[model samples]
Target: MKDSLLWDLSDIATNETFPQLIADTKKRIDKIVTWRKHLSPQMEKKQFVKMLNEIEDLKSVIACIYDYPALKELTDRTDIKAREMKATALDIVIAAEESVRFIDHWLQGKDVVGPEKLNDEQAEVLFSIVPEHKHLLWRSRELALHTLSDVEERIILQKDLQLSEPLLDLRRIIESEQQYKIKLDGEKKTKVIRTQAELSKLTTDANPKNRESAYRVLFKEYEKNLDKYFIIYQAIAKDWSSVANLRGYNEPISMRNRANDLPDELIDLLYSVCSENLGIFHNFFELKANLLKIPKLRRFDLYAPLKDSDKTKYSFAEALDLVIDTFEGFDKDFADKAKRVVAEGHIDSHPSPKKAPGAFCATIHPKITPYVFLNFTGKTRDVFTLAHELGHAVHSLYSSVNPYSGQNPTLPLAETASTFAELLLFDRMMQLVDTETQQKLLMERLADSYATIMRQINFSMFEKEAFALFAKGTNPEDVSSRYYQNLLAHFGDSVDVDQIFSYEWAYIPHFVNSPFYVYAYAFGELLALSLFAMYKDSGEVAVNKLKKILTFGRTAYPIEMLQELDISLQDRDFWMHGFSVINNWQKNVQNIFSHERI
Candidate 1:
């Protein structure tokens, strides 16, 4: 595929045929409803298997019907018909879920109080009939503990349908519509960049003035619409808090912890380990300043390229080949799987004025090769993003042995392959460059480490405080002030953070899209660091172990699946070891800078 090329949509239904696809999905849903009506704990194993098959079939169809329009809407935000179709698809899925709510209620023994109903133990006994799906069924029982009564569940679903959709859509619409103008380093004329991805390129522009101007341009729009964005965010927070409270979670983040099937204590440990390691990043910033020959580093200079850094740019095809080659160095099977996404024409490889800003991999179903969406600008980082997203696709492909119910991973484990992909590419690039270029690569790696680990942890910290403040009837301005304080604590004396940076919180889509989702990036990056260390030491053996974990998919909890690698979720030293790997890299960069003057 060429740069800025749209993916082939023929594999998915066209607008002319999409309505029929939804109609067919509804018919399957009706069939599943009939099957659910007859479901019982005491049913024969053969009958139970048949019901499972029907449910999986319905889910497969629903995935396609829903994803078709959703993918279209992401690529072209101005596609009104795509938006409406996505809404219709969502409503149908919600109704289908409501119609089959009896399954969970019956499994939890909530549908009836008498002896005929099944409790957790009895449900597990029935679930044992399908050995491959036992964990999925058990997970359902765990979630049912937090499930509300049938009436309350329906009300919440209806409320979400009415309130959540438009709020999220508003954010997407505003972001896609915003534009920025910046003067090139050597040119007097200004360039108009319409997408966030394009604007992000200027933040790392070689000229310091252009770098600062990019930040100003980026935050200015957010500051202008501060009130509107805050209102939307505040409502989203309250809505999430209300639902989490009704479900009996102790705190806002606790709900996310439970959804990931992780213990709250584990997340707490991650926070503690990262907070204690703040000095590592602090020293790295000083090292960065030394290499740049600057007295101090500013927040806007976090991602600034080294003064003599290599400025080589890759074409779309070159980037793809590099990623595939990097994966092939680990395992040819991995390289082939990454190529399948492209061969199937499942990647949208460029930016557009109306396209979504960031990158993501959407796995519609286990049988389908995942579709990747990117705003490729041909920078080296964009090459890593290509590897990152294709890593997600490889993860999905590896887990194809599972049924639909077991195909999706929890948030914490979801970043494993993607982060590992970037590291593999980093390793490959490091081997091909000279000493100075190696130093530059190390700097880029450290910058990414800071972004993925410290930055994300700080975002989660702000979220924890923001949610508490929002619950106390605090306004947006107060929350903004608290966020600024949070940033101060994060940077400490290492970097200068400006007040305009406080508006940065509103610019992050995760806070509005997925609350508490930032921690997963930290979780994944640390976990990947540890995994990369293993791969470096043991080679193919470690590679096989990593594959085993991915193959498990949602078949087991993250902690359980990670046992294949002997990883412990509750061990403080385990998390600390990941930080140590980063510390070592920073030390190497420091050593390199000490030996030479830029």
Candidate 2:
């Protein structure tokens, strides 16, 4: 159930004080960056340690202000004290960067502090900000924004290096049509699909005829203009590879794992399991075809309407009520926060052309911790998306309370609470509905779970093989062809291979926006589902343990975090529990189909 109490930001009383706070904070931080350049690019190791301390001190102050309730929300005093506090902290960050710049300046050969017998506190400065974001917000920038300027240094040190240039360019490609051309066949078409968000309306169309055509028109444009987009991808790949080479990582992907601090064994274990279990998805597809009484299940049919047209269509308000009511059943604390967010206007439920595709929660800095920019289109699917994104907001809200903290958990860990909440709500929703609706709901879950499991794992295999082929000096055509061939092998005979093949990868936003990121969905979903099984068996005790992990901040690493729920990353049987849950649903779907044939 979704919490009805979520509010839109426009309704929040941020008033004059909040705006000033944001303004002053930006200015203060900007100056700090400027001052740091006094030190040469290469400071002695000793001087670098001194600069790190100054940063830790600034983070402590920022954390204090963030912990303050008025700064977290709106000021009751209207005194603009929040503004001053924000600005001062921003100034400190600027100073921290200046210290880095000073180190940078000294690297070119200049005098600086020595490591002569520094105390334990001085040694711990960098670690102090590890789980907290106060310094990372800048350190990552210092490494990336200065990329071309300090190429050798960047490649060597920054496995954790964040690059906004590629992402910024991607955003431009999505929003700006004139910047990127769209072509069809051997000819360039005047009718270009402007952005990825535009494709969402196209891709999710109800009619299969419409969906097939929409995808064709949309992908034809991408396929023909491959050189342009491929060039952008090439640059990103080349840069990442170069940086990885510099960092002494075996590959760009290895560098990513290093930066994320993710265990290679865990990743390998996930792939090994998923690869062996692909038949699960194949069975799911066959079951869907049976229940729908169709001869074969095509890719477009995957997201088709689960129930007939006469079934209930949820209004946004009704959906909100259901979501709110569902979550309240879990506990009152969850219910109260949800109610306030809705009532106070913390959500932007409407979707627009200018807004980005997909939904995410940005803490927007701990001092002014607010969730921004949601795009909803009133589908029952949208209801789940709302629950999912709100879960992100809830997780972020908890993490933001401390200020100067990392936004939330590590990537895989971040999805745990959000997906778990959805399962909790979905399960209860199933219990309340009639038997027919229950069947439909179970079908939806089976479809969704298969996608989370096989679709993503198949994608991971595609990336690995594609990149491996590329490493052997393969051309774009070879890579594309190879990908299409493997996709057919994965999707099998159930889908319209000719129409949806090559262009399918074109629409995957994750491939363009976040590389090697698809696996996390399967990883998180199965992990959460397995944990949900425990809850069903143990009830409230299980729920309490999971909640503790969510609120633990990033103090715990990924493995340690899972321990809170007593879920094991090491045990194959743990994942098998969730797989069996889907398998059980498949049996039900199969039985329905068997009867329908009569």
Candidate 3:
């Protein structure tokens, strides 16, 4: 809820001299390995401990740079700040990549560090991803960070967004807009601030007319310069796809699945099953439309708020209180540490210009702790977003102590704790709503599912098709037009998707950004729902098991982590059981409407 949390990178982060930091970390890591190699087979005690301490010191530096960007400078803003940040990022990346190569390409050849020091079960866990590539172990400038830099340099910053040979010179215009002295509305009175912040908040204004006007303004600007946003997105896809190919991946999906250690069967199964069940989502949406007393659902109606209820506006302070209270019911230790996150400057919870929209949690370093970011606007969804990201923070916290590198969960497992936390809050609130307001509450809950499960699944489907098209050298216009058409069909005839949503493609950072990341929302939400449903019968012991699962991190593959909960997701019935719950819940909704007559 706190809008701005101070970042303390100096303590754990690199000294900003990236080259020196990389050089120093390399020395420490090499020493640790050297000591390991020299230790006599009979004499492995205090010497090992000393080596671990040295490794921790180096990890602290690597994590601070990658995890907590908001603290050091180049956040989603200030090109100048990002310049130096990029250099530091490059150093961190190169360090990681080199480390991974040494362990996988080099150490494996040398025959060292297997499951003996670790339990056999623990040793089996090393089979995930690059086992040699632990958290800070395989920091590669080439993988994510450097790719981002190269793209930004050649695509985002250096090459203009517009596609023209006249050297359009739009950056200068944008920079001038930034400096234009003008007063924007809202929290900041008509006081002069930078134009970027002013332009952005205009879209999120409380006033519908203002929000609509802001949308018009945005597209008008973008429409005139469609070439830029389009070209950048195209280049990014091309670059990532090419990189994936060069790295010997069949496609981006392989790389993604590899990160999660998911088998081809599991992923293929998830895609098939989730796609097959859009009926449950459709039924849920139809119920929502009936509750809202509308003939049809609109694009805007998809996120429409409930009416005639006690809507208590929560300040940032109030929002934090609600979160701490809800999470405390689950685990006191969790609530305690969550408060520390607030006390320290871990959360950046405010809307600002040039800063990325949406919320995310950063796993800075296992040795330190994780941080959460949000653009809290005191809305109902904002509270849940906070809870969701907190789930990620707690998950990261448990994985920190696990010495094994795989403790960092895959993307599917990544969303489990966060979405589970949200369900806890949602179910508790749904139970408390008044009889007359239950319809509204049900609609609200259904809307959340619609976004997470329904919409995300649709996005995944679109990405699958679109990426395939792009890979064959389809032009940007063809990709964008096809994407717009697909978005319309997915939403169904209920929504007037023709207007107010076409430009949606340009704003979606995920599709242009991270390929195949959206389905994990649908995957984790259903998994969490299934697991939470089990808690009703299992009781307190189940709660402990849930916490233990979070601690599993990368140690257990997605399928194996479910095993800890005694639920195997691969079981056709286990997955269908998730669908059955949704059907039962939808029936409950029908009953709620039916009981209205009684």
Best by TM-score: 1
Worst 10 residues of 3 by lDDT: 137-146
- lDDT tens readout by residue for model 1, 149-242: 8788878877876789789998888878888877766788988889887788888887778888899888988888888889989999999998
Question: What's the C-alpha lDDT at position 96 in model 1?
Answer: 72
Which residue ranges in model 3 land beyond 4 Å of their true spot?
A: 1-57, 65-69, 72-100, 108-235, 246-250, 291-293, 306-310, 315-318, 333-358, 374-378, 436-438, 471-473, 499-503, 579-598
In model 2, which range of ten residues has the least summed lDDT?
67-76
For every candidate in turn, the CA RMSD to the true structure comes to 3.3, 7.8, 7.8
User: Which lDDT tens digits does candidate 3 get at residues 57-127?
Assistant: 55666665554444444345665654566566656655554443333322222223442233224323332
**Deviation from native of the Cα of residue 309 in model 2, angstroms:** 5.2
Q: Identify the candidate with maximal lDDT.
A: 1
Name the regions of candidate 1 deviating beyond 4 angstroms.
1-6, 9-19, 72-88, 112-116, 168-202, 213-230, 350-358, 375-377
lDDT of 2 by residue, 353-390 (tens): 44335566555444444453455666767777777776
Candidate 2 regions exceeding 4 Å error are 1-23, 26-208, 291-293, 306-311, 315-317, 351-358, 365-369, 376-378, 400-403, 493-496
